[model samples]
Target: MPSPTLTRVRQAYARIEAVDRPEVWIGLRPQAEAEQEARAIDARVAAGEHLPLAGKLFAAKGNIDVAGLPTTAACPAYAYTPWEDAPVVARLRTAGALALGTTNLDQFATGLVGTRSPHGAVRNALDPTRISGGSSSGSAVAVALGIVDFALGTDTAGSGRVPAAFNGIVGLKPTRGLVPTTGVVPACASLDCVTVFARTLPEAEQALAFMASPSGRELPALPQRAPGPWRIAVPPRAQLGELDEGWAEAYEAAVERLAAAGAEIRHLDLTPFTDAAAMLYEGAFVAERYTAVGSFIDKLIAEGDTGLDPTVAGIITRARDIPAHQLYADQDRLAALRTRALTQLGDADALLLPTAPGHPTLAEVAADPLGANARLGRFTNSTNLFDLAAVAVPAGLTPAGLPFGVMLIGPAFTDERLARLARLLQPRLRLAVVGAHLSGQPLNPQLLSLGAEWERTTATAPVYRLHALSTAPPKPGLVHVGEGGAAVETEVWRLSAEGLGQLLAALPRPMVLGQVELADGTHAPGFLCEPDALPGTTDITAYGGWRAYLNH
Candidate 1:
């Protein structure tokens, strides 16, 4: 049986079709397609599947190939048919996830204002009058509305992170080349990265892990899964621009939550970061985007029937004129700016910044497309351009009900450390974890030991089983058996780096950390045993937790 949460997800997808918004999708999978996927996932689970995101439904940004689906890329004039799935899509498919369909994006991955698509603008789920930030517009909406557990998008310059924040979700932009762009359309081949959008951090992280390549996985061989009082950097008050008082308040609340949980938060001047952001478009990078689609875009324009997004066309038009010498000069400047930004980061565990400056309405976006869009990318555009890895976590909603998000950015390969910190900060966050650290048990303490704060106001989906393993000192293994497990009660927890290290070092042999899908239809790191440990061990799926099993 599908977990109630997954059931609800299915029902929500059904309802979403009634209020179909083509602006968010270029091509949506039919009911039969979704049903076919569900049956396959059920089969995997029935056979004791061990894949990440098993049974999860996700959508690919239209720029990616999904095997049998056309890559519209929000531009009908530039569609292509690929015989095979994109690398990331194939990975997700292999993990037993169902592809809901392909979503719309900013045409050619060119704009942040969602409206650049030929399909139409993707509206923010919370407030339809508002714009869903882009170029990964539709992917964010699908996740925010629960139409899919998570969605895939590509980010060359904040396309992934911006839309995520606008739609109240987590957007994770891994290190460049980490998720493989082999099957994905390129905006800037060297800079483009496939990203994940989801309602919760755990979901996004789970998708990221499934998609992460060893070559691009930048996590340190840390001590363990422990969160600590991390030294975090933030935008200096002076550098805070374009005020959204509500976002400011939520940002402060997020800071307070971290402080309450013992994190050392520091405010630092982000002047250098601002400078780097300017370099992305103002320097050589814009030319890179032009170079990426130069021939295709040029051919269309030459035919005089180029219906490219006007703004995208304008951006590309400018790229056509840059001299090679000027491009080299800009590249040299980017190097200096990168050094300065890193120096500002200066050994802090991670830099914390608003995922977007504030939310902009569709009206505001339509009126001032470029400015409104740049405001959203102020903190994010510099990431990939400077070779940084980042993870955005929901900070909570502002008093005005707008979602506030904060991101932890680190030098390449720091995703593991950042995830640890985001976990510890979850209470101050509205994010959920459907993984192994569900609280009020031994494993729960492992989360606490890793600096994970609990959100008492929340609960998980009850889709997993609690197994009492035969390991020393004992450990409760929560596995998503999608078969006969009861609704297991568990708490969601967040952690930081120092905390992650401690938990990892403390882990005993035979009990390793692996992915687990929680009752909430989300995945998290949980206690996993190498097959050798399960023999002769009693199957305690009836009891939701180790404590419950022992009590009986």
Candidate 2:
């Protein structure tokens, strides 16, 4: 479970205290603002006023204006004091959520890697060595750290999703315009979307529903049933380059799972998608960002903003060269390309792909700024670029213990269908525990690495025996039998098939991967005992669960 909430918001404030690193935030809310909001939430709960978000706290990306704070987008010179919150922020506020602060991002939301900000490189919370994907860096990290329950970020070419993937959280990029951007700093205004990041799919979706306008905007309906024997496409095999082998294997397993769940999978040409991505900078859409942040960057440079990161300047500089004539041609080509690409995906419920090719370190991003950031945008850049909606939910971890995720992309207004599919797939999160493997364990570096969430589960049924294998790395195995059985305590991990595949392959001899039946009669893949490896092993099932054995 996440850290327990505080009736006094100030108690919860402890999580926000400075960590060893600082890049996730550009600035924070005033002490008075935080205190007042916390008090207000407490009062509502005491008075039984029915707070929608209850104790939820959130942070907005730097570019979105929030009341009582500066909207800097990481450039101090470009700061502005807004009198009111952005429409989305206002929506969250009305829903009873407290605003924590403003988070760090690539200056003017120009880069995908978190290192492009002057505040500090947003390091991965799980492994301080890796980059916390961006430009929604701070928001995603904030949630990952449990300092906030949910956060608001922006997505244009993967800004929101990348950070979520990096931080091992759920990043929900709503359909274009699904959430208002009235007070936001636009990356590609026409393509920008205010996205959500949370620990689970339901939390993100709950915040999204609460984000609806008071006027009660109608949501798109979920497809009534399975996409009717749909023909879904995976990315072309040749372009799966630079991907971590774990992600590729995990993704393939996900494909198989989907096929089993009644969706047809196929491979389709990715030329159109790549062609569109090339147009983002190579074409005129660069001007849209300039139109949004260009004026500010120009003023900051003139007024002497020493805080603007160099790479941000370089990225903004490219926007200056996009000619007006080229924009029309690019738009025309984009329209045609989108039609072809959508047709390719039209026969399917949604497209599937790895959220990122691979995770990288902040140092790697710093060494080669543009290329590394671009590589992180592999599956994500095309979503908002083409005005499609995407929801990235946890698939689980690869054998290497790295988090792997898959995103479902669909046409505009299909947020409901996308969300339904995401929920239907939510049960895939069964997680098993040994030692600190339980929720809130300190040794869960791998859990944080793959963003494996803690789950509710029961022990394997009475047919299994638990044995602590004296293996070097330390692991346990479950054996099945009709006699001499004990109900061994175990955790059922809800994993993405992609994460399961790599984990399965890494099983050492004497320990085989197989299914274990749970107390509830549900089965999740787990470590089964190889008859050969049981020698010298102690049957500790009497302890009930591995946690009990470890505690003793």
Local accuracy of candidate 2 as per-residue lDDT tens digits, 1-552: 122123435544665665634567777766666777677677777787777876778889999999878998887777899999998898788877888889988878888888787788888878888888888888988888877778999888888887777677788998776688789987888888889998877678889987655453356674554435755578777876667766777877777777777767877777778788777766788888777777777777788778878877877767888778899988899999998888777556778777888888778887889888778776787777787888887676766665677788887777777777765444354555543345545545655555566576567678877788786656666788858887876655556533544454344567666667777877766667787778788888889877777779
Off by over 4 Å in 2: 1-8, 30-33, 214-231, 424-552
Candidate 1 structure quality by residue, lDDT tens digits, 189-236: 888889998766666788888887776545556434245568788776
Query: What ranges in model 1 sit over 4 Å off?
Result: 1-12, 47-49, 215-228, 428-552
Could you estimate the TM-score for every candidate?
A: 0.75, 0.77
Candidate 1 Cα lDDT to native = 0.74
Candidate 1: residue 459 Cα off by (Å)? 20
What lDDT, from 0 to 1, does candidate 2 have? 0.75
In model 1, the Cα lDDT at residue 525 comes to 55
